[model samples]
Target chain A: MRRARDPFFWGLFSGGGMLTALLLPALFLVTAITAPMGWFGMTGYEEWATLAGHPLTRAGLLLVAFLAFFHAAHRFRYTLYDGLQLYHLDALISIVTYGVAAVLTVLAAALLILVV
Target chain B: MKSQARIPTGRISDPGYPRASNPEYTRHHPRWYRRRMPIFWWLRKLAYTKFILRELTSQPVMYVTLFLLGKMWVLSRGPEAYETFIQWLSHPALLAFHALVLAGLLFHTVTWLNLTPKALVLRVAGRKIPGWAIVGAHYGAWLGLSGAIFWILAGR
Candidate 1:
C-alpha cells in the first residue's frame, strides 16, 4: 500500500521538538537569563564572535534553528486546524506553514555561512 | 403494520433535516445530533488547556530562533554591529518578551520531557524497560547536554 507523506513531516516535527526541548531552555538560561543578569562575569563580545565564527558551532546553531522552526510550523499548523477549526483550509495552511519554515531555514543557513 | 401505516411515509416533518423514509427504521434508531465541537473546547478541560499552552509555546521558540539568527547576522557585520544588537536587547519591551519566551521554554521542556517516555519503548532481553527508566534517560540526556553547553560557554 502506498503511504502518505505525513510521516515525513511528523518525523521532522518529532526530531525538531526533541532538540528544542532538550537544548533551547539551557541556551535561554545562559544567553537571556544568566548572562544578562550578571550572575557570572559578562562574556566579552570577542568570545561570542569567536564561538559564532567556529564552523562546527555555526553548523550546530543552524541545525537548532532549522529544527525549531519546523517544529513550530507543525505545531502552529495543527493549532490553527483543530483549535481554530480551519480544517477546510488544510492544504493552504500546510503550504504556508511549511513554506515559512523552509524560507527561514534557508535564511538561517545563509546568515550562518556569512558569519565570519 | 397498523403503527407503520400511521407513521408518515412520504416526507419528514422538518424538510431541512431529512429522516429515514422507513418509519420502523426511524422508530428503532432515532437520529443522533452530534454536538458541534466548540471553538473554546480547550478551555473546557484542564488537560486540553495544558496541551494548548504547550503547543502555544512553539511560537516563542520560533521567535527566539529568529532572534538568534538575527544576532548571528549582526555579528557577521562586526563588533560594532553586534554591540548595537545587544543594546537593542536592553529595551524594556524586548526584555519583557525574552522573559515571556523563557517561561514558555521552561514549560516546553517540562511537558516535552514528561511526554518523551511515551514515544520511546525500550526492551532489554525480551523485557520491557519501565516507563520511569525511559523518562530518567531523557532527563539524564537533557542534563548532560545542558551541562556540556554551560561548560563550553562558561568554563573557559
Candidate 2:
C-alpha cells in the first residue's frame, strides 16, 4: 500500500507553525521594522550581506522557509474549505495552494542557496 | 407486515423518490431547508471571526517568509538593488502593511502556542502536566528564541 501524504504534510505544517511562532516576530522586528527605520544602528548593508551569506544562517533560513510555506498551504486549505465553504473545489484548491507552496519553497531555496 | 415493510427485500428502489414522496416532506418546512450560508458567514459571530482571523494569520507568516526570500533575491542584484529593497521597505505604505502583517503573525504565535497543550500532551510519572506549565514552557522557549535572534541581529 502507498503511504499516506496527509501525515507528512501535517508534520511539516505543525513544525513550520511552531518554528514560525517562535522566531518570526523577532525576525520581522529586526529586518522589516527597526532595521528599516535605522534603529539600533542596523544601517550597514555589508554586515547583513555577510551575516546572510554564512552557511549556518542560510541553512536556518531555508529550513524556516520550507516548513513555513507548507504550514501556510495547510492552513489556507482549511481556511477556504470551512471559512469560504469551498469544499466542493477540494482537489483544485489543494492542488493550487500546495502547488504554490512548493513553488515558493523552491524559490526560497534558490534565493538562499544561490543568491544570498 | 410492518416489519416486512421496514426490512430490506433485496430490491432496488428509486434513490430520491421515496424520501421526496414522503407525506411529511412538506414544502413549508422541508427537512432539506438548510440555511444557505453567505460567503462572509464568519462575520456573524466574534468566535468565528477570530477563528478565521487566526487561520488567515498563516498567510502573513507565508508573506513574511516570501519577503525574506525576496530580500535574498534582491541582494543577488548587488548593493544598489539591496538599497532599493530597504528603501521600499521604508515607504509608509509598505511599512503600514508590514505592521499589520506583524500583528497577524504575533496573533498566530499566541494562539498557536496556547493551543500546543492540546496537541502536545506530556505526562510525568502517572500524572499529566498542567496546561499552564506547558504554555509557560512555550512562552519561555519563544522568548529565548526571540532573544537569540535579536542578539544576533541587533547586537553590536
Candidate 3:
C-alpha cells in the first residue's frame, strides 16, 4: 500500500491557518494600512532599516512567509479540487499549488538573507 | 447507454466492471451517469459560497507575504530603494487594494477562530470543556496579540 502524505501537508495547512489568523490582521493593519496611510508615524530610513535588518525580526518574518505559503497552498488546492470540481486535474493542481508555495518560501528565505 | 449496464447481479462473476470492456454485461444494462458537479455549485448554496470565500482568504494572506518579501528585498538595496518601496506602498491605489486585503484577513481570522472549538475538542479531566470557553480563550489571545502588535508599531 502506498503511504499517503496527506497529514504532512495538513499540518502545514493548520499551522499556517492559525498563524495567519492571529497575526496577519494586526500586521497588515499596521504595515499595509495605517502606516502606508500615514496614520502610524513614519520613523523613516534608520529605524525601518534597523528593524528589518535585525536577525530576530528577519527570522520571524521568514517563518511567517514560509508557513503562510504552505497554508495558502493546501487550502487553495482543495478550493480548486472540490470547489471548482477540478478533481480530474488532481495531480496537476497539487503540483502547481504546492510547487508555487515551496518556490515562494525559498525566495523569501533568500530575500531575508539579504535583508542586511 | 445500455439498459442493464448499471444493474448488479449477486454472482461474483457479474460484479461491476467497465461497460466498454464488458460489452455483454452493458448490452442488457443502462449506463450509470456520473453527475458532473456544476462550476457554479457554490453559488447554489450560501454555505458553499461562504466556504469558498473562506478558502479564498488564503490568496490575500499569500499576497501580503509576497509583498513583505518584496519589502525585505527592497531594504537590502539600501535606503534609497527602501524609501521608494515604502513610497509605492503608500500609493493611493496600493493602499486601497491593501484595505480590501485587510478585510479579507479579518474575515479569515474571525472565521478560523470561531471554528477553533470544533477543530480542537478540549477535555478537562472527565468532562469536555464548553465551546464558548474555548472560543473566548481564542478571542482573548487574539486581542492580546493584536494589542501587543499595535503597541509595538504605533505606540509612543
Candidate 4:
C-alpha cells in the first residue's frame, strides 16, 4: 500500500541521523584526546562554529537537521497513536508534528546560513 | 434451581500462618485480595519500567532545550565561539554525560535507520526495497564513514 507520507524524506533523515550518530562519537573521542577533559567546550564550540561556517558542515548539518526533525516527528505521531490512543485524533497529531518539523527545517536552514 | 443449590461451607486454611487462631479468609470473592495481591504487585512494577523508558527516550522538551542552547550558542559566536563552548564538553564529568548521550543517540540512529524502508518510497525495477536492505545500507555507510574519519584523523 502507498504510504500516507513521503517515505524518501524519512529514509534520508534516518540516514543522516545514523551518520551523525557514528561520526559524532568519534569526533568526541578525538576531542577527548586533544581536549583538556574530554569535553568540547567553547573552543570545541568554536571548531563546530567553524564547521557551521564551512560549506561541507553547513550542507551536512542542514541535511541532518531537516531529516532528523521529520523522522522524530513521525515517530512521535506513532507514539501518540499507540500509547495515548490518539487514533481518533490522528489528523491533529499529524498536523502538530509535521508543523513542528517544518519549523525545525527552517530553523536548521537559518542556522546553516548564519552559524556556518 | 437456586433454592436447591448446594453450599459447601468449609473453613479456609492458612497453612503458612498456622499459629493464628483466626486465619485470614482464603475463600475467593470478587475482590479476592489474597489471590490477586502478587499479580497486581508485579504488574505495578512492570508499569514503572515502561514509564521510565518512555520518559528517557521521548523527552522532547529536554532534547529541544539542549538543542536550542546549541543553536543559540552557534548564532551568537559563530564557529569561534562554538569552539570555546565545545572545549568545556571535555571535562571528565562532562565526558560521562557525553558517553551517556552518545549511547542514547546511537540507539536513536539504528532504530531511525531501520524505519527508512517503511518511511520512504523507494522502488527498484517495480520492486520495493526490503527494510533489512535499507538498514544494512545505513550500517554499511556508517562503517565506511567511520573508517574514513579514523584514517584521516589518525593521519593514515
Of candidate 2 chain A, the 10-residue stretch with the lowest lDDT total is A1-10
Tell me the TM-score of each prediction against the true structure. 0.83, 0.86, 0.85, 0.55
lDDT of 3 by residue, A1-116 (tens): 11157989888888999988999898878776776566766546666667778899899998999899999998889888877877689899889999999998888887787535
* Candidate whose DockQ is highest: 2
What is the per-residue lDDT of model 1 for residues B45-135, given as tens digits with 9 covering 90 to 100? 8999998898898898897787777766776788788667667776778788888898998898888889877888888999999989888
In angstroms, the error of model 4 at A56 is 1.9
Error of 1 at B38 (Å): 3.2
CA RMSD of each candidate after superposition: 6.1, 5.4, 6.2, 12.9
lDDT of 1 by residue, A36-101 (tens): 444565466788777778899889989998889898999899888878888689999999999999
Find the number of clashing residue pairs for candidate 2. 0
Those runs of model 4 whose alpha carbons end farther than 4 Å from true positions after fitting are: A1-50, B1-84, B91-94, B111-138, B150-156
lDDT of 2 at B133: 95
TM-score of 1: 0.83
Poorest 10 consecutive residues by lDDT, candidate 4 chain B: B34-43
- Rank list by TM-score: 2, 3, 1, 4
lDDT of 1 at B36: 86
Model 1 residue A74 CA deviation (Å) reads 0.9
DockQ of all models, two decimals each: 0.56, 0.72, 0.67, 0.16
Candidate ordering by lDDT (highest first): 2, 3, 1, 4
**Model 3 per-residue lDDT tens digits across residues B75-133:** 67888887777788888898888889999999899999999988899888989999999
Q: Count the backbone clashes (under 3 Å) in each candidate.
A: 0, 0, 9, 38
In model 1, what lDDT does residue B18 have? Answer: 40
Q: Write model 4 residue lDDT over A1-116, tens digit each, in one string.
A: 11448576556435545555556544444433334343233334444344445577567656656655665666666666655554579889879988887887787677666643
lDDT of 2 by residue, B25-88 (tens): 5447546566789999889999989999999988899889988777766766778888888899
Those runs of model 1 whose alpha carbons end farther than 4 Å from true positions after fitting are: A1-5, B1-34
